[model samples]
Target: MDNKIVVITGGSSGIGRALCNCFIDAGYKVAIASRSVEILEKVKSDLRSEGHEILTVKTDVRVDNDCKNLVDKVIEKYGKIDVFINNAGITWYESNEDGINIKKHKEIMDTNHFGTVQCTKYALPHLLKSKGSLVGVCSIAGEVGLPNRSAYSASKFAMNGFLNSLRVQYLNKGLQVLITYVGYTSTNIRKIVKDDSKSSHFPPGYGDAVKEKGMMTPAEAATHIFNGVKKRKRSVRSSAVGQLTVWLNKLFPRLNDKLAAKYYS
Candidate 1:
């Protein structure tokens, strides 16, 4: 195909799904991957557009084999990948004192941090060959640790560090690795969070707080991400709140900590 191609992991819903639709609307060949074949098919059906290619892959980013398969399948369909998005991630609430679910924390890391690592590792060769743009769907939690998102924060921090190094490593090779410090957006992630034990990592009833508040829509976040990738930006703060977190943590570390404690504690 003469047109460019984009591949998005975790593309069944939320920001990933929004990116798939956005790229489809922009006339790019889009490949959407997730572990759920049913949801993936639903997304493909909903987002299908004329004269644009949309392929779905059942991929579990936590497994290296699954990640490799996703990359290989995409390469098989599209000769080259023009843009690769490592958007597969999972998160649950955790705290040192009360909601400390150690196992759940590890699970979060497996999916959020290592999942991105696995996908990126497999996709790197193809990305290098195409000199494509690569984006990590990180969170504001990556910049500063929130009270109840220790694991999630750690994963995103890892993501930023990893991609930052990758960006420099590939800069001379004409490849782009960008990070998006996304703030809470209206998505089903909160609703779908795992509770591995009776004393769940999640608070009893705090699931949709991000959505209930006037959070940014996934579409808006995806638009910001797409634009950043286009401009070859090193990072894009998906929300002013996320930007505030980064700046405040930088300039007024103590005050930022106090505020976070007050809000989340």
Candidate 2:
């Protein structure tokens, strides 16, 4: 994979950042996209000091032109794309008691679902040409809805469906689509919700609950995702818990529903 090119969005932090390091260690050329120019520069500088080179692009995935420019820039630098990871996403914590916030839901959907779609649209041709992998960093919430995560769940479900459809459509076309169902991971994603007002409504102890010791680290999650992409897997569960939740939901729908409610509560 030394000469192969990999593109990752949301690449300045968390699992995305870990993935950049993982791929670099494996000798693949990496290009990262993020909305924050400062964060991108910082990551680039840190990696450069460690003797790894990377291309950084300022991109807001929610914008179509930005997504297009991201792919264009990567192709300009690397000539071809071997893997494109749709990892840019956001979430909110809100309960039914907090009242439905359509605006918040739309905001999440725009980033999580539509952002993935836009990036895929521009990157598809390149991926197809190289028989490359297209990956979605989805969540367990996509497999089974969780309480207080209506917006996040809906967006992920949409993403899952979209990626699944692409996998089928391109099955014989030599394009690989991989969806990773990630469970709770030690990432600051939860803390970066754009809506402070709604995030403040998170139930007491919710943060502690999510930060339990068993949660996977971003590096661990990145390893799972990297392996899946390397093997051209159709799907991967990032944790034992995530795998169990998906299977239980499939075999015991109602029971899983009740368990999900209790767990999130």
Candidate 3:
């Protein structure tokens, strides 16, 4: 995969940033897109010290035009795209006093679901040409809905559905589609956990315990992601605990929910 042109969204922080470094270490020409161009530039400069070819593009994945421009600019600079990683995402712990609200639902869905679709629309042609891979950084939440994450769960569920259908759609075209159900990996995402009380429907210390248990570091998660892409695995689950969740959800969705409540509630 040396010199492969790889594009990753949400490349400014956490798993996205870790992926940027891992791909560069593997000798791939990497382009990272995110809203924080300042932080992105800092990361690029730091990596350049190690002699990696990295490009930064400011992008709001929620916008179709921005996604288009990201792809266009990458191809313009690198001439081809070998892989596209849809890693940009956002989450809110609570939405309303009742349960999940339409406002938060729209925001999360737009960023995590539609944002991925928009990027795929722009990158599909390039991927097809290169016979490349399309990887979506979904969550274990995609497989099993969690308390206080109705909207976030819905968005990941949508991503999983879309990618599953897309895999079948592009099979004959030789496009490899990977949908990953990653579990809790310590990243800045936890810092953004909404003050659920402000929204009035907090999940009663939902994040407190889970944050300590079964959480891997960003570098650890990125290593798993890199391996999945390199092996061209159909689906990647980060941890043993994560794989158990995926299987249990598949085997008994309702049962998994009851178990989540037992543990998190």
- State the lDDT of candidate 1 residue by residue for 1-265, as single tens digits: 4888898999888899889878877778889889889998777666554444488989888889998898889889887888999898887765455556678778888888898889889888888898888889998888888877777788888888988988887779988888999877878777676433332444333456353465788899999999998898888998887788789999999999997766544
Among these predicted structures, which one has the highest TM-score?
Answer: 2
Per-residue error at 5 for model 3, in Å? 0.9
TM value for model 1: 0.91
Superposed model 1: Cα runs more than 4 Å off = 49-52, 95-99, 194-211
Per-residue lDDT over 137-196 for candidate 3, one digit per residue giving the tens place of the 0 to 100 score: 999888877777889889999998988899999889988898888777767675565433
Writing each residue's lDDT as its tens digit, candidate 2 over 94-209 gives 86667778998999999999999999999999999999999999999888898888999999999999999999999999999999998888776766663365544443234542
Each model's lDDT: 0.82, 0.89, 0.84
Clashes of 1: 0
Candidate 2: list runs displaced more than 4 Å.
Answer: 198-212
What is the C-alpha local distance difference test score of candidate 3? Answer: 0.84
Name the better of 1 and 2 by lDDT. 2
Lowest lDDT 10-mer window, candidate 1? 195-204
Q: In model 2, what lDDT does residue 237 have?
A: 93
**lDDT score of model 1?**
0.82
CA RMSD of all predictions: 2.6, 2.1, 2.8
